[model samples]
Target: MRLDASAGGPSGAGLPARLVWLCVALAAGVAAIALGTATWALAQSPGPAPTTVGLALVCAAVASIAITAGAAACVHRLARAHVRTKASASAGQPVAGQQVEVYVGLARRLQGLVHREIQLLDVLEAQVEDPDLLKGLFQVDHLATRIRRYAENLAVVGGAVPRRQWSRPLPLVEVLRSAIAEVEQYARVRVVPPVEGTVRGHAGADVVHLLAELVENATAFAPPHTEVTVRARRVALGVAVEVDDRGLGMPHPEQDRVNALLADPGRVDVGDLLRDGRIGAWVVSALARRHGITVKLQSNVYGGLQAVVILPTPLLGDRPPARPPATEPGRMPSRGEPTGTATASSSMAGASPSPVGARHHPPAPPALTRAASPATAPAFRDAVASGQAPRDAGAAGPLLPRRTRQAHLAAPLTRGGPGPVNQPAGDHDPTLMADFLRGASSGSGEPPAVRAVPRH
Candidate 1:
């Protein structure tokens, strides 16, 4: 439920008026007490009968009560007037002929705000490279992006804009992969793969915005270094995308807050969590409602928040479209190889294939290293050979040149072993390696795929 300035509540802008009323009540009580004491003193001093003093005290008490009541009523009325004025001002603003216009304006403003906020964050990031600082910056950036996306989604819906038919079947895998890449820049986490193949649906920009908000919110509230898993699957009726995070689970208070916000979009205090100064959730909800998409928010099995967006099959129609055949040709039926030959082939595949003589010579270590061989060289080479590692994996060695490596090695290993490996190494389990490679290579490899339609 939204609670804005116009909302009739003690905690709103009328708080000041409430305080005034409270003060007035206190003063009246004090005055009544003083008057009673004076009346009692006068009667006891032989100036007036004790009964007169009592009567005077009663009158003073009645007067004080009446004054307090009047003051409260006056304060209430004043608060009501203040609220009405604010509401009138908002309503008096010219209403756009189309919701789309309003939405587009909101989106543009949000975009500017986000761009400015991100620029500010970049400066902050350069000033302090601490992990905590970086994490916070990422959180803020993610929030800003979410707000911008929500605004954009609203704009799309307000305009009754229909996305162009995808030129070809969408590479759902590629879309999700790109999203994961974008998310990784700020999230101190990894995204898990979906259980099924690419989800087919209406390819549009709204999909990206929906996924971004869900993933971002999950990351922001999740525990540090936890993984956020995204899964997409085709249900009998439509497509479902699930984003799961293993962070601080949603508590009743937060749930209540979100529910209240959804109920009353106007009451949202967007400034609290987002740097972009826009109400992200309200925009998201509005967009979702406009599109007839169903969004379910729930607690994840891993004790974190899970957001599921189910886009009805055909997304815009009733029947699922036929999927194209796979790109790769089917494998030929293989005759059983002799045991010895099979063993040799397996050995060859498992062994490092780089020519021995062609191996790159290890560069000399710096002053700090003294005698130690740069341990990371082998690992770095192995990572690169794996073929699907993130770009950083290939640049890891040179980025740390020999000198920097020595410095890193010399620094007291605060935690045993090297800093947590950001990406899996070549030696990681084959299944995991395959998944990572798939995600790295294609933008649509996971849930929350990229927009399949080309933007005009």
Candidate 2:
């Protein structure tokens, strides 16, 4: 089989520029040499000989420089190709971008999975009272949160959005603490000065995420024993959050490059972070540029890096009150907990009576183990009082086997023939009538009592 290949990129464009430079250099050197040789041959005395020799030497130097440059470029290209081959061999694939896509796709899905697990774990955590169980749940929840952050890192590198946002403005202090809580080295982070401001709801989530990235970077590069600290203070224009660590600081040139990227991330797509391996700086820069936030890095007094994020006036708001709306009644809102508003099935849920259509439909006749006759109305009172499933004669428990009595068809009525089977003609007690009426009025799924025909 034969393969077709089309040259592009440097092969089609950049290769010509290098060749043109080489040709120009060679032409200059050759012209100089030719001119020098002619000058020397035509020289009538030693006075011009010296000038001719100098010109020839200059030509030789030019040729040497051009040749060396071309040779260096060839060696560099070979070295780069060798490195790529080695990498391809080690990784067992030529398509690294495909691997990145797969990894990021899985990471995003894993993020959702971890979030759901954390939510379930949160619900379970609230229900369990044992200290040990609560501790275990907290640990699991923490791990899930870490996994969520890792996934966010992958998402940011993949040029995707982060997965957190506050529906309302959060206090600056709270945002800082929340960001700190997300880092793996949370224990080492200490917040100071108790800032007073609110991160605008629109920017709260991204700000928190940005801060978390900076904080994580700080802690990761720091020694285990050293502490990373965060400080936030209200400023005239907005909020300034500083994250500092005691780790070895970044070099000045690197710091300047990072700052430049943060200041002007115009065309710098964060997706390049996959190849760049600078996830933290790229994430910080991308978020900062997007949110109108500014990030500046400086060497700390303790020989560490300090990242300062400036939240502009628009992204700042008045601090939220200590008691949020949900907590005004003395409790935090449960996640997605239903509000106090009335619902279609509210009657079933509370003291109010359910309308006929809104009530739970009564069990079908065949499913009924009991008579399901008018007498069934009274059983609801017992069911309600005892909080147990109502029972009647021949009524079996939900799981038990019971014979389904086939309903008999009533014969046509006639004076000589037996009349249709009649229900027992017991005297209607007013109290039973009242109880039955009460149960039915209460929408207790009570069937109405059958009426009897008076004897003529």
Candidate number of the best TM-score: 2
Which stretches in model 2 have alpha-carbon errors above 4 Å? 1-108, 153-163, 266-276, 318-456
Q: Report lDDT (Cα) of residue 415, candidate 1.
A: 20
Show where candidate 1 strays beyond 4 Å.
1-154, 157-166, 181-191, 194-203, 256-278, 316-456
lDDT of 2 at 325: 26
lDDT measured at residue 119 in model 2 versus the true structure, 0 to 100: 57
Cα lDDT of model 1 by residue, 1-456, tens digit: 111111122323345544544554454444345344533455356432344434444444454434333332332333234234445657896433432243345334434443454454454445444464355445444443433343344345344343323422244444454455434234443445433333333444555655665666676667667778777765433457787888767676766666554445457553341223223354455546655567766777787777777765333221112211112113110111111123333233222211111012122232122112232333334434543234323222233323322223322331233332311122112133333434444443244222222133
The clash count of every prediction, one per candidate, is 20, 0
Query: 1-456, model 2: which lDDT tens digit per residue?
Result: 000001111212235534633453453345335334534433544332344434543453454334323322322222223234446766896734443454345446645655555555555454555565455445545545654555554555444666666443456777888788777678899998656556666666677778987888888888989988898764434568898889889889777767776787544433332234454565566567777888998998999999888887556542222212211233221111111222322222222111111112222232242232222233333333433233121122232333322223231221122321221111111133333353343233233232122123
lDDT, candidate 1, equals 0.41
Give the best candidate by lDDT: 2
